[model samples]
Target: MSALVNMAAEVPENPLVPPIPELVIGLVAFFIVFGFLAKKLLPNINNVLDQRREQIEGGIEKAEALQAEAQQVLEDYRSQLADARHEAARLRQEAQEQGATLIAEMRAEGQRQREEIIAAGHAQIEADRKQAAQSLRQDVGKLATELAGKLVGESLEDHARQSRTIDRFLDELEAKAASDSTKAEAGR
Candidate 1:
């Protein structure tokens, strides 16, 4: 305790004030370090900062170019879509026209076929009517020949005589039938 007290009494009166030589040495050392940092480290730091700035600008430029390319691609896609829609509409219209043409052709063909069928039917009916008329004439002639043979006591076996008799009888029958039809109409 006595030694601590003696040491305290021997201590400098102004402890906050350093000696002049020490202050000068400290100032010299600080200047040397500051000068070295300013000459060497400061330039390296500035170069690194400039490189980083260039990299950031280049990245921004690349991003802008990519955005422009994407915009162009989107525009092209939209144009193609519009073209496709127009083509689809054109194809649909063409198909409708073709369908209408096909329907018209089918109707024409059907009409032609119907006309041909009607003509064929008329021809068939005429042929059938002629055949029936010929058959009725033959039947009436045969009946008349049999009745005449019974009445006159003779066989009508001669072809020419029989044909003549049948024609004469059919002509008289047609005349009588015509007169009868006229009388019936007058009565009506």
Candidate 2:
């Protein structure tokens, strides 16, 4: 260690190397370059990096807001769709019930109308039978009076003769009516 130290001290500095004036010029050039880079290039680079960071953050916030709004809209639409379906179901049920009730009422009305028509027809037949019986009785009575006048050799147009003839005719008519009723019963 002592020999290495003495040899380093005895060695003379090389004159061929850079002199003090050259060294000073080199130092000055290096300081000027470093100052220019710090003032212009470094500030421009920092500004560009800051702008890029701000743009990225803003884009992330906008995406989150759009996602939230879309979720809200989707929920609202779903609720509305459910409400519409429920309303449609209610309307369908109501329409079906109304149709059933109307059908029942129509059936009842038709039955009533049919019964009324049958009753009217029966009443008309009864009235026509009574009218025909009265007309037949009048014609039969006139013929009986004529026949009695011929058979008895008397004027049956007189009241006493007419009464006797009608009495005989009624007795024969009652006997015939009884016989016809018995025949109808046996047929049934």
Candidate 3:
């Protein structure tokens, strides 16, 4: 050992190599700093990292849950919209059916009114024709009685006799007209 010490002292000091004492002191300082970081700063940093990772995972889960809820809400809205559209269509169809029914009712009412008006018109015309015929018959009877009186050169003034003669003459004329119409129909 003494010989080794003497040999080391005689050796030239290399510029690159640290002296032994300085190396020892530097090594000791490095150990103290490493220990402090491992015991205190390293644990705190790891804990912070763990907290951050947990927060990120929680945030992601919350986002996924919110997205699922939003999707459900969207589905509900869409279903409601579809139902509303269906209801609207049904209402529109019902309205159209009601409109068609109303139109049909109106048309039927118009037809009924038209038939009534035509019947009323025919009845009025028949009444007017009968009145005219009765007036003309009276005039004809009066004229025939005056002519008969003139041709016979006498009054023949009795109400019952005049009525009977007029009635008999009109009846014979009606029979002739009826016979003529029947004969014409038979010919056709």
- Per model, state how many residue pairs clash: 0, 0, 0
Q: Write the residue-wise lDDT of candidate 2 on 42-136 in tens digits.
A: 99999999999999889888989999999999999999999999999999999999999999999999999999999999999999998988787
lDDT of each: 0.96, 0.89, 0.95
Best by lDDT: 1
Better of 1 and 2 by lDDT: 1
Distance from true position, residue 37, model 2, in Å? 4.5
Query: Runs in model 3 with CA error above 4 Å?
Result: 1-31
Per residue, candidate 3 scores C-alpha lDDT tens digits across 92-116 of: 9999999999999999999999999
Cand. 1 Cα-lDDT = 0.96
Each model's TM-score, in the order given? 0.72, 0.66, 0.75
Tens-place lDDT per residue, model 1, 135-182, is: 999998999899999999999989899999999999998899999999
Candidates ranked, most accurate by TM-score first: 3, 1, 2
Winning model by TM-score: 3
Candidate 3 RMSD computed on C-alpha atoms after optimal superposition onto the true structure: 4.2
* Of candidates 3 and 2, the better by TM-score: 3
- Give per-residue lDDT, candidate 3, residue 112: 100
